[model samples]
Target: MTAADWHARAAAITPRTELFIDGGFQPAASGERFDTVDPATGRVIAAVARGDAEDVDRAVRAARRAFERGDWSLAAPAERKRVLLAVADGIRSHADELALLDSIDGGKLITATRQVDVPGSAAILQWYAEATDKLYGQVAPVASPDLAIITREPLGVVGAVVPWNYPLETAIWKIAPALAAGNSVVLKPAEESPLSALRLAEIASAAGLPDGVLNVVTGFGVEAGAALGLHPDVDVIAFTGSTAVGSRFLEYASRGSIRPVWLECGGKSANLVFDDADDLDAVADAVIGGIFGCAGQVCSANSRLLVQRGILDGLTERVLERAAALTVGDPLDEATRMGPLVSARQRDRVAAHIASGRDEAELLLGGDALPGDGFFLAPTVFGSVPDDARIMREEIFGPVLAIAAFDTEEEAVARANASEYGLAASVFTSSIRRAQRVAPALRAGTVSVNTVDALDVTTPFGGVKQSGFGRDLSLHALDNYTALKTTWFAGA
Candidate 1:
């Protein structure tokens, strides 16, 4: 469809405005509402239900009831698998509507939401669904007449708090595995992008999910998210966001029943290009996609670029050329490669980082916002950034890149691993020896060789250190939602 076609469709969309609790749509108990705006045009899309502690209590109580009543939490594995697969099918059928919701509510590029985000979410659900019945239990090799069975069981009443960056996709990342494990869930989507999540709850309900099995509470983090974290009955809390907020969940867990908390937090990842790299052009392309894709809002974005001094000048020019050629405009336009930041507040945060870059490093590219109703910013690049420069150390979560040069392999590895975060890193080089050598040396949860942030459902995704622990994708992610239980039988 053309740009005009997309805009017209967006205009015609009547966003769902209520919270999803107990498998039905409802308003906050306080009767309060908050405006959700389209960052693309800075226009109010709809007034969403503003859930607080009272609403969270209702959702959690519903989830607890569903779990204890065996409505979903005690269902057969094959039955759960069927429902999850059907939910995946539901998502696929409403691809365009889901894509449009994210674009208008969160300023995600419509093309990305349609192609990558929506499809990726469905694929994740299907992957977990397929694995649901395949999980196995272990029988202990005990002496005659005595037997021990060790099995993985679901943790009940999971509270999932997801960020707004990849709203639907991230929500599915947390819920699919939780649901597949036969656990009831209460999902708290970021207030900035609650539309798609609310829609998803409806889709799941239509797909045969039991009422109260998958509830969604929409509101500010301080209210809804905090309540979910602190609730005594929640068996687990799975969160993805900033380090500061992740720490808050830790504290909340400590104060309560001390339930398992899985956190996937912030990152300031580094990308290294050695002098022996075979393809400078390919490396430059990866660099652009690494930091500029999603307007650099990704938690695992490679915002810090480390280049060997020999090829520093050459690669920097190539990256700058690509940055200059990028088109920044309306998110609904298929041709637009980058969209606006999620909000005016985020734009200002990024702008503050750029301002610090100007004072601490040599500006090689853009550092200004585009003139439009949207919250767009020109991609910015800084060179010769000091090791201590705030831009190099902090996550400037915008289209900003910090370039630093190193003299040797050891220096590159050292500089890359210098950050407190160990979420992800990348190494672009042609030599097998260097690739093997440097990838292992990098202190990141996932390292990409000759690429950037390369990950799939087949592999685990997460980080170490301040980036937080616990895995997100792959079969290992199921570990977060399950616990090992050993049942013993003795014959007298």
Candidate 2:
């Protein structure tokens, strides 16, 4: 079907949503409520259920009970795989609707939301589904004649606080793996953009997920998110958001010494372009798409560009020409290449960073707003940004690209390593020697050469330093929601 058909199908989703606790939709026990705003138009999207500590307690109770007594954790691994694969199919079946909801609420381009996000989300669920049956524990080599077996078990109830930019997909990024590892979850989706996540529960239930196995709580972060993180019954907390918020989660998780929290936080990643790069045009395309594609809302955004000094002038000029040509408009428009920032507050924050760019860095290109009713910032580029400037050091989190020049290979590595964040970095180099030599030295969890933001669902994604710890995606992610127990018996 065509785009308009997809939009109509997506718009038909129920706007009035409530907390998904246990098996069905219900209001908060305390009667609390809140309004969810549309980021694109600054209009009220829906009045959603607002969960407080009591709501959290109820949700946690449901999740804990389900994990401890339900058929989910005790099911054969193959059965779990079947459920998860069906969940994947469910996601794919509703792909058109989910993509449109994401596009409208999160201010992402429909092309990306439909082509990349939804399909990728389904693929992730499927991969985890297949992997559920494949995961194997080991037997210990003990000194005694006793038999020993190491078993991996679900960590009871899990709490996941997902971000607004990638609500549906990121939710699955955490939920699918956690469920595949056999844990029930209470997902707290960002209040600004939770439509797709709410809709997904129907699809998930249709996929055969047992009641209370998956739940969604919609409310402000300080209330719902904090309660979920600090809930006494929660066995593990998995979160994806900012460094500041992540720190609070770590603190809350530590409140219960019995359980550990797994965090995936911020990033100020680097994309280094060398003089010997083979595909300058392709590298430029990747660079632009990396930072501006999602309005720089990604945790692994290549916000910093380290270009070799030799080709700096020529490359900057070419990149600027392309940046100027980027189409910024309403997210619903098929011709609109770039959409608005997620919120007005985010737009103002980006504008402030742009205001400071003139005094702190060499302003190369667009740094103003696109004339519109939406939160649109011009695709901005700054050259020769000093390391200490706010525009360079902090996460601008908008469609702003800060470029720096380095003379030597060692200098590039040094410059890239200076950030307190180490989530991801990319290198554009033609030579195999450069790729081999440089990839290891980069101090990030994920590194790509001749590509930008290229990630596989099967590989791990996370960060170091202030970017937070633990991992998301892959089997490593499964470890976040599972615990191992050892059994031993003397002489068989």
Candidate 3:
């Protein structure tokens, strides 16, 4: 659609603003609501239900009751698969509506939400649905007539806390696998972007999911998120957000029932460029996309650029030239490649990072907010950055790229792996031997040899160190929501 058509559609949209518990939408227990502002226009789009501990408790109880009733947990694998496939189909059918909700609620580019986030979420759900019946139990070899059977069973009542960045995609990453394994779920979407998840609950119900099988609660992290983490009935808690909040979830889990907590947190990932890189221009393009894509809100955002001292100047110039030409404006506009930050508060946080970056390194390109009604910040680039600089060490989580120079491959690897986060990293080189050698040397969950943040649903996605643990995609993710039970037969 053209920009005018998109703008018209956006204007006509009315997002869901209530908490989705069990099979229907309802107001919060406290009857209080908070406004979710549109970052692009600085207007209140909707006043969403303000869920707190009581609301969370009610949702968890619903999930637990549904699990105990065996409406989903005891369904035949084929039946479960059929229902999940229907859910996937439902998501596809409502793609535009879902995409619009995310774009307006989260300040994501409309094109991205329509083309990438919604489609990817549907595909991920379908992939998990197709894998449902393929999962099998194992038979352990035993002596004589004795038999041993090892079967994986669903962990009932999973609590999923997803971040605002890529809201639907990340929620599907958790929800699909958890549901595929026959577990009931209580989803808590970020307060900033709750509309889509609330609508997703409606879609799932219409797709033949049993009542209370999937629920959505929206509120701030300290209230709703803490309740989920500390709920004794919650068998597992899966979360994606900042490291500080991940730590708080850990504490909450520890203080309560000690449920299994899987976290995918922040990162300051580095992209290494050696002089032997085959295409400098292509590498520069990758650098731009790696850091500035989604305004650098990605968890695996390659915010740090480490280039060999010989080619640093050339590569930095190429990246800056491209960063300057990017169009930043309203998300609903098709021509805008970069939208505003998720909120004015986030823009201010990013501004703080840029201010500190100016003190720590040379501001090579844009570092100021644009003059507009929306919360817009120009893509920033920093050069001659030190290893210990705050911008280099911390996750700015914005369109900020810090460039540093290294003399050798050893130093590059050392510098890249120095962060507390081990989420993702990238390396660019023409030599096969160096690519193979350096990839394993870097301390990260995923290392892209010549690409940045390369990933697929077929491969596992997660990180080590403070970035947290537990896989999120592929067959491995099922392990996070299920546990193996061994049964022994004395005389089979």
**Best by the lDDT measure:** 1
Worst 10 residues of 1 by lDDT: 10-19
Candidate 2 lands at a TM-score of: 0.97
Residue-by-residue lDDT tens digits, candidate 1, 67-169: 9999688888999999999999999999999999999898899999999999999999999999999999999998869999999989999999999999999
Off by over 4 Å in 1: none
TM-score of each prediction: 0.99, 0.97, 0.99
Off by over 4 Å in 2: 1-7
lDDT of each: 0.94, 0.86, 0.92
Q: Point out where model 3 deviates above 4 Å.
A: none
Q: Which lDDT tens digits does candidate 3 get at residues 137-229?
A: 999988969889999999999999999989999999999999999999999999888989998999999999999999999998988998889
Residue 273 deviation, candidate 3, in Å? 0.6
lDDT string for model 2 (194-282, tens) is: 78888888788888999989988888899999998888889888889999999999888777555787888899999989999987778
Candidate 3: what lDDT? Answer: 0.92
